[model samples]
Target: MSIPLAVVAGASGFVGQHVVEALRRQGSEVRTIGRGSVADATWDDPGAIEQVLAGADLLVNLAGRSVSCRYGRRNADEILRSRIGTTAALGRALANVGSPDLLWINASTGTIYRDARDRPMGEVDGDIGSGFSVEVARAWERELWDAPADVRRIALRMTIVLGAGGGAMSPLINLARIGFGGAMGDGGQKVSWVHVDDVVGAILHLHRHPEISGPVNVVAPDVVTNAELMAQVRGSMGRRVGLPEPRWLLEAGARIIRTEAELVLKSRWVAADVLHESGYEFSHPTLASALAEIAGRAPRGLLPVALG
Candidate 1:
């Protein structure tokens, strides 16, 4: 007979804001903890966050430096530090709290899985990849493992989240408009994606389903190839064609953009096996339909695409 109080760390981010809005829409009281916002407290004040968590039913940590930038020495270090530091800090805070019913949902990436061109990777059988991104993801989940024994924890191995305004969809839409939204690196790489709304829904579902824990794949049922993904973007934007970018060209473009080609070049064929087994139906299951919905709400602007 009481509404749940959800405390969202890193609440000012693109996904964080959407998750907060979704929680509020579901009649839950939301408190945010992050830097420079009117959160309950910033990361600098861990005690205040602990106080907030004591009264919370759910704690979702979406804090991390965006991996969309160029992975230079400085950037790469910060990327690792931000995720591990935030998760460790949250674990410390949770340790101080006495709430047994608290559920912590931390952000993990589907990129942790190897470049699986063979078949779709799932929670049970997916092979973990090595390298900078995969290492960061592994450490991120390790922090969660150190949390108190009483707390329930789940690491969302999220794929590329498609949404309006600030996600993979916006830049792809821009590229489609500019007639450069083409398949990269032979366009055979598999791209696993999920709608932002479904992401929110899945988080809530996991919160209610205590039977599920550990790293769960949060992607959609339908995964598309790089060529099909570009074609869908072009189709949604009313364009017929996109110039294909080869690996050499992608490397050059990545240097120019100060980012890596791995974001687009790597094959990430992931599936939501846990969610499917738990009976969680996706709101936007297919790439074409998901892109159409996002495109309708996407702002009309020529913002440069930063494929992460």
Candidate 2:
């Protein structure tokens, strides 16, 4: 029998590439679309993406503009417009073509929620965020939901994905290795983090067990404050110089870096009840162990056998 095919978008980004590799490991074929020349479709060519999706087993949309760019009306607007526009175009294409009964997974963000006191935010707990990241998430998710119901769909509200390769964790990991990584602001704000392996693993679960739908939280169970995270990184890296940047310093730095002061200084303690309750197993459920493995300080755990 032929293996099922998946139409994957955003093949150039960190998680997107990881997803493609994960699927390949599971013996599934993948076709992609994006500008990096890695994916099969370029940004403006919706028909190419649509053609990729036609008769495919899955449609995974992970395309978006990175929100870490320096803050400006134009820059922030581009971030929002890129996500909204890509999602809109994809949705229109999916609607126009007779979509297969394949599963559709749209990428969202944990930044959708406002701050709370270490509270574990869930799917129904509405208070979607207010910053440029939140705005992008809001519009991106809306366009995703606009698709026809014939294709089963789900939105993955992802947290800060950590690994040795790419993402928000990369710069921090490098600083930590040099004994310079430290808390951003007051050290009181929380951070929700997940291992890149677990992020890819959970999607593998979705690929095999298609019943899971709606907005799934792709994060680790334990959330940490900036102080605690810095402490762990310092301890794990065997470092002694990690320190806290004062709020004023971070604010000033944000302006120079072209990002919002709040992005660097704010707390985001998201959770993953959806992933847990549904029997989705996480390889690095804890933060310390996850950090250790990523830093090559610990042994790689037993690899899970990928399902078809």
The top-ranked prediction according to lDDT is: 1
Report RMSD for candidate 2: 5.7
| Candidate 1 C-alpha error for residue 241, in Å | 0.8
TM-score of each: 0.96, 0.90
lDDT tens digits by residue: candidate 1, 1-308: 23389999888888899999989998999988888857888889988888878779888899998898889899999999999888888888887887778788999999999999998888889899999899999989988897654688899999999888776776788778888988989999999998888988898999889788888899988898999999988998888998888999989988887888899999999988899999998889888778878778766668656443
Cα deviation of 179 in candidate 2 (Å)?
4.5
Summing lDDT over every window of 10 consecutive residues in candidate 1, give the lowest-scoring window: 299-308
RMSD values for the candidates in order, in angstroms, are 1.6, 5.7
Per-residue lDDT tens digits for candidate 2, residues 208-250, read 6667788888888878887788778777667777857788877
Residue-level error in angstroms, candidate 1, position 292: 1.4
